[model samples]
Target chain A: MDFLRRLFGGKDNSSSSAQEAKKRLQIVLINDRTDISPQLLENLRAEMIAVLTKYMDIDEPRIEMDRGHDESAVALIANIPVLRIKRGAGGTLEDRFEDNPDDRSEGKFSPRGEPPRNQNIKSRRRK
Target chain B: MGARVIVITSGKGGVGKTTSTANIAVSLAKAGKRVVAVDTDIGLRNLDMVMGLESRVVYNFIDVIEKNCKLNQALVRDKRVENLYLLPAAQTRTKDAVSPTQMSELCDQLRPDFDFVLLDCPAGIEGGFKNAAAGADEALVVTTPEVPAVRDADRIIGMLESMGKSPIRLVINRFRAMMVQNNEMLSQEDILDVLSIKLIGIVPEDDSVIKATNRGEPLTFTQNSPAALAYANIAARILGENVPLLQLDSYHSKGFVASLKKMLGF
Candidate 1:
């Protein structure tokens, strides 16, 4: 048991030392290729989320900015939700008329009708 | 017999291409063979510095090509070793100063006088690199254990293959055995697995290397330095001597019994 402990312990120490060297090299190369630092990547991530929020309803938790294999490029991936009018909500008087069975004979909902409230909420969330 | 021209190149910068060229050139020269090491980096030449002949360069490679001086005028003889010469690159001129035809012609001229002509190529796959590799009969790809360097080396190998060059050898430099033992650094096996080329030499990171370079001396001059010894062994290997790869870990590590006592509660 003593012999085994000594042998394995030596192996473990050497293995860890090698690991540290590898980590240092990987980090140094990543920083060398990309002018952006780790802190900058975090700041960029925050700013990216803010900009993406202005256009559409996004699942904030799902948004990610990843470094490329070359370390010279950045990738922005976001899940944006498209906004559309709700079937029934507080809208223009035309929407009430459109909802009426009698108005069914006419074409789709009138342009004056308010867009869906849920969509309005989504857009307002962006603000 | 005509000398074989081999260019050591890497697409990525700081991957020890110049160092490999210098060491290999010194190794070949030590074997009593006439060898010439050419620095093709032009504006950013480091081969002369690595070979400890930077100050001795009176006429640059550009002078030879432009007919400003004779080839012998540009060649700098090493005082430490006989039959070893350095053809330095011009610090004032850029890569565009030399063409592939001129480089090929230059190598052809040197072939009759020397047993080996090693070209120290510059970083990047540009005009300078093309010029350095144009007339080479073979190539030595130098790369670190890192992924990016390995990738760049792979691209260089591909380019050499496209140029119909064969029997290219791979030299893995700045290897840390401790890191490899810890599973942190890429092993020689890993690099060979990716490159799939004949292994020529594996050089460990030695502090003596920096010290030797700082003094403008190649490591091969110092018998006490392991790095120098490694270079000597590589030179022997190049001369068809089967020298075993230096096991750095085993040399540095304490005995197994001592390590075992430390592991136990004793």
Candidate 2:
């Protein structure tokens, strides 16, 4: 109900009803389409944040995670805005920047070993 | 080599599955195609009444399924339109009375005789739905522009896809154009995006439909009415005609509310 209320901007007008219904349907159908419950999705997001935080400072509140579908398959799309990498937290700066092709091939989200079609990790560099 | 058995179904109740079935059947029949609308609702039969053949229903679908009556004997020929018939469902029997195999057999029997065999499916995704959809080669999923209806429709579409039913088209029934313009109702695009199926019809909310249903007549019997034209368009599309979608009257909001909507980027 909180999401529904937020969807309509706390207005009870007829104009807002459609928006509310659309949002409610889109949210509810994610489970049916992806076979992942919202609770489970939330848990996954939380785990992702926890893991990513170890090597990078991500803007958790601004993280957008949802199931996106293309002609081929449904994919777990995450647009996590990275504030900066934790250079001193885990390893050397050069080690943290190391991008292994093997690691990239093993997708973080794909449970069936199929890499996600799109995994956008936007770096929000703050000056 | 036979009629394409297309099931007109909606998982939710009272979303115009029966209405769409009646109108589309009538339209197809009027277009010189042999069409039969079978009420697969069993105990909740309304297709016969909608087609104005309730009094002439001597036999029902269950009778044919149980071998109590021949398929031809159970078909109620519509006197109003040539090549149109109604296979009424039994009011006394529950949905359990007709098994999926029996329904498929019934469809096969009607296939060679008609150009299109339309099964009016009952609500809910239960045994009744399975029985109705068992014989279907294609599907017409009906839903209103509401949350619950769209959700159930998505579920039905999923089931139909899993069953390998191809060319599954959507019919968004009882659409209020003005409400959609005012952002009071979900738009056609919103629904199609969610359902992710090809759209065949968008029936506008019309009083004529209620009047026709109450009189035991299909709205398609009337000429050029909004809902009638919509149903006729659906029929034409089914026959592989290149008819464009019906254009409903558009509305523009005025004054303070309009400014508010503009401010909200609606």
Candidate 3:
């Protein structure tokens, strides 16, 4: 298993077996707490990342499974970093700054349907 | 008006549910409250043995429910502790012999007479677990700070909550503080974090506990072991006492461990 992990570039969870058990347990418990499978969660994360990547420069997207309780419903938690937007051709951040200086929306990553999104498209003339 | 039937359960076997039931019952009765500890494991009954009331169990819990004997007739009084009783399970019969509703009704019938009624639940989330959990208004989920145990505890806690059982508290059994401190075992905080339940108490892994069980005595007998003190604290907390949690590592376990085992005749 160690050889396989090293071969596959898999990071070891922990050295101590007890802490390993705890780490494994936390993951297993989260899975057991919800009906959703880890594979499905991974897929969800991937799909969401793909959707977000198309609109903005997202860095270090992470999905965390936080259990509020054993009895309560499971909640999905995600954190995505938006560096900047992928604008139209010749719509680099520098060009946008030159055309509309002090455009707060320029080079900023904004969620779809938000105010900054329209402002971003207006100055860049991107769809 | 009636006593609260709190079922002591662990989804996995050999995690010390019966032991917890016996010690907690003894602690409560010693504190001057009327207590009855029922062994709901049916075929594999051991609570009677743990309470040292095995010989006195003339009529089992099934006998009372089936009308073979009166409820009081089947209840075996503890020899050492006053106001403490044991309702032994029928070792010869299977869990299928008793139904969930029947167990619920039995607890309901015994409620008004005692200050607290405790059920020693069997392992697994099957029929026996359902029957044991049926009558209880509260639950005490027992688990060791291990992977398999915590996983089962999580499932059991989920089931109990879905069943509408209120105030489910966790009791971490057989904890080894040194192992946890060295990161070779899961810490109490880690277990609680994963399980996400209110921690009632933590019983340290003590050598005296094994001796106590072998002698058919509850660990709380000598009050010498950290486990014994832990059980007593759990009982006190159950009574709404403002007892602080025991710091296991600081219990002077170094030299105290040797002296306690010797004094306990282990």
Highest DockQ model number: 3
TM per candidate comes to 0.65, 0.71, 0.71
Candidate 1 vs. true structure, TM-score: 0.65
Off by over 4 Å in 3: A1-14, A36-127, B248-266
Off by over 4 Å in 2: A1-15, A36-127, B247-266
**Could you say which candidate leads in lDDT?**
2
Instruction: Assess the local accuracy of residue B128 in candidate 2 as a C-alpha lDDT between 0 and 100.
Output: 92
For residue B84, model 1's alpha carbon misses the true position, in angstroms, by: 0.8
Q: Which lDDT tens digits does candidate 1 get at residues B14-85? A: 978887778778878878999999999989988888887878889998899899999999999998988999
User: What fraction of native interface contacts is shared by candidate 2?
Assistant: 0.73
Arrange candidates by DockQ, descending: 3, 2, 1
Which pairs of residues collide in candidate 1? Answer: A6-B260, A15-B182, A18-B178, A18-B179, A85-A116, A86-A116
Candidate 1 lDDT over A17-37, as tens digits, reads 334444444444433433445
lDDT-wise, the better of 1 and 3 is 3
For candidate 2, the per-residue lDDT at B221 reads 83
- What TM-score would you report for chain A in candidate 3? 0.36
lDDT (CA) per prediction: 0.74, 0.83, 0.81
